[model samples]
Target: MKSIKTKHRIIKAVSALTALVLASGMLAGCGGSSDKDSEGRTIISVGSWPPEESDALTAMNERKARFEEANPDVVIEPDEWAFDRQTFYAKAAGGQLPTVYLSGFTEMPEIINSGYSSDITEALKNNGLEGMFNENIMDIISRDGKIYAFPTMSYVLGLAYNVDAFEAAGLMKEDGTPMQPANWDEMVDFAVKIKEATGKPGIVLPTADRSGGWIFSAIAWSFGVEFMEKGEDGKWQAKFDSPEAAQALQFIKDLKWKYDLLPASTIINAEDWYRSFAVGDGAMTVVAGDYPRRVAKYGMTPDQSGIMAIPAGPAKHVTLLGGEVMCIKNDATPDQIDASVRWLKTRYNNELTDEYKTNTETTTENAKKDGQLVGIQSLSPWSDKAESLVWYRDYIEQNANCNLNHVKLYNDFVADCPAEIKPEEPVC
Candidate 1:
């Protein structure tokens, strides 16, 4: 696994200073009341980065309208802001951060330790959602038994393959089920067969950006390698300079050079990789479970898409855990904080309410209308396996446009594999 550096250096320095100033201001009752509009409605801004004409943007707008209707005292504000390492400090220091924003799970520890996030322990308890979160996820955003953020969604990295390509390559069992490789050698063989059968790259790898390192880490972890580890002195150190790590990198190199199974353009990122895979230009790619929606947008049907656990390595099978955590800004007023919690609960926790049911139906219908993927399988942030399956069973059976069978292999793996948190970047 490759060690990824901290994406934003300024976050570590500025957040602590900002927190101190805000904490002092709070004692003077000076920082909390500035978030109200002239109409006296509490303004709650949400951060997102959907393109103007995208289905994601449309869905976000619809959700905002529903949230406002349910809470008359609050006004929803949409900020077309995406998290970028270069610009995050500027936005945060300039008081431009939205009341609620999406942050990567990898960033939560630093964000929490720096005091940039609001402590939402009380809020979760007050809303009766304290015990509902998946413990593995909650542990990432919590410190000293206090949670600073909400787990919005979590996903495991897996092999997303073209079902048609697999079948054409005769990579299916006698019963007509896709064959899942148990180790790297089998995976390589399958890739070669698929590429020979279909004149396309056997697999697409992200090698141009940090995602390259991210994906590499999952592959290495499966081979029992860690990018960094805490030492006996209680300080983190890089451990990737080892034989196991070398073997992992060599495997990727072999896929490109030795096996000739990868594309000549080796610098593709997520967008480019998705474009190729969705259009049937590649046999498979390692991606998160949330990729189905993007696949759908590219005109791939559920039957054409298949997902499975990342093939096991010599040591064990593992998948990388990734997701977004919802956070409130540090300087938000108590009223704003309360409002944020209520909004989260309305969206995630009140699944049994009529309002939520109506919203779900509307969302499903709109997704169908927009040709978006509905009921894609993913890790639930709010419930355990048994509860999550039961909680969304009706919605899945009724509105899913994708073939659930394509995702069954992944679902079964997640049901048993113990999820490990992404490794924190090593500090020099």
Candidate 2:
């Protein structure tokens, strides 16, 4: 195993931030009225609160306490109301949404057009966060030159593999690094090698719950396939049926039939894919950037995980970029909006403020204690010059518990041969 204390080289900062923990930056608790409780402080309800028995709840509460102590006149009422497409509109229509809540980046346009969220342009400017965001991220949460949400984090897709499986298959380099696939073609050969040596499915592709289409899109993009484009009249056009898409789909078919590299089962969803990869039944899977918490839950040790760039195709290399944003409810009062901004800043500010330090320290300590893996690749919504980025890197390095070689491999790619980042297109 690689030393956890190995010095991590300074890599080019990617577009995402390391997901400190799933429940850390986005804090929510039991849903409640967005009004003053027993006290006179203005209540700002927010979502993504951990369950009562979760270790994360204690961390959330600690953050809540610190936030309350800092902003005495504002109170934060946590909620567990995660965004669900099916239930969101009903909640919005019933005026039951939290003052500030986590939402998908793609949902912003709909939420804004439907008047379900507040325009926080002025609030962002007021809080010294106006210039922190990457412009591409700004576009996602903005409409008509006004900002409505704050992008907390972003991620790109990559090939996450079982380190031990690759070694068992004699796929490791002399320097103890995994022999990562460089292109889709090489991925096939590598899959065959792993299967022949380890007697396990070499790679898994998700096929159920629409993830089959989702994964295929990335592979298609690598093969130089554009799924959609605007016509001369400005109407959107579908282009996914091109010959390149057929080639990509054919590759998947060959994996199952010609190569016999995929699992025997015909059905595999995102959940099953992660489970397979975690247990080494499937040696590799496409994973969104960051340490995979779900894989860890399925019993994979930190030392067993490794991530590399998504294999390129004939035309180019690309990865899908996506993240979560914080949206304020449309009807929130000025005080509520201002309070929400203050609260959000604590989660994603560029300055090395006391609040930021406390939040990071608390989250890191709690994650360490919870038997979680620390330090993985991520993209940040903030600019490259965000001062706190340096602090965060040092902190993670000092406290990292995972095998640093894996982190080095992923970060080295981000710093060296980073894939072209493409934002996800909206579904019509």
lDDT (C-alpha) at residue 400 in model 2: 76
Task: List the candidate 2 regions with Cα displacement exceeding 4 Å.
Answer: 1-41, 51-54, 228-239, 353-355, 358-362, 365-372, 415-417
Instruction: In model 1, state the lDDT of residue 322.
Output: 77
Number of the predicted model whose TM-score against the real structure is largest: 2
User: Residue 411's C-alpha lDDT in candidate 1?
Assistant: 67
lDDT of 2 at 95: 62
TM-scores for the candidates: 0.81, 0.81
Question: Model 1: per-residue lDDT, tens digit, 1-428?
Answer: 11123424445455666688787765353233367888898988777747588877877678778889888889877778877756665666545678988888887776776567898888878877767887667678888989899887788787888888898899865553578877789888898999889888888878867778778878888777867778899667888898888888899899999998887788888777788888887788888877776777788776687787778787677777777878999888887888898888776653466666666677668667766556556666766532433656567666677666666677666656643444334331
Local distance difference test, candidate 2:
0.77
Instruction: Please give the CA lDDT of all the candidate structures.
Output: 0.75, 0.77
Candidate 1 stretches greater than 4 Å from native: 1-43, 49-69, 72-80, 90-96, 174-176, 230-237, 365-375, 385-389, 401-403, 418-428
User: Mind giving the per-residue lDDT tens digits that candidate 2 earns over 134-185?
Assistant: 6657778888988888889887778888888888888877565777788989
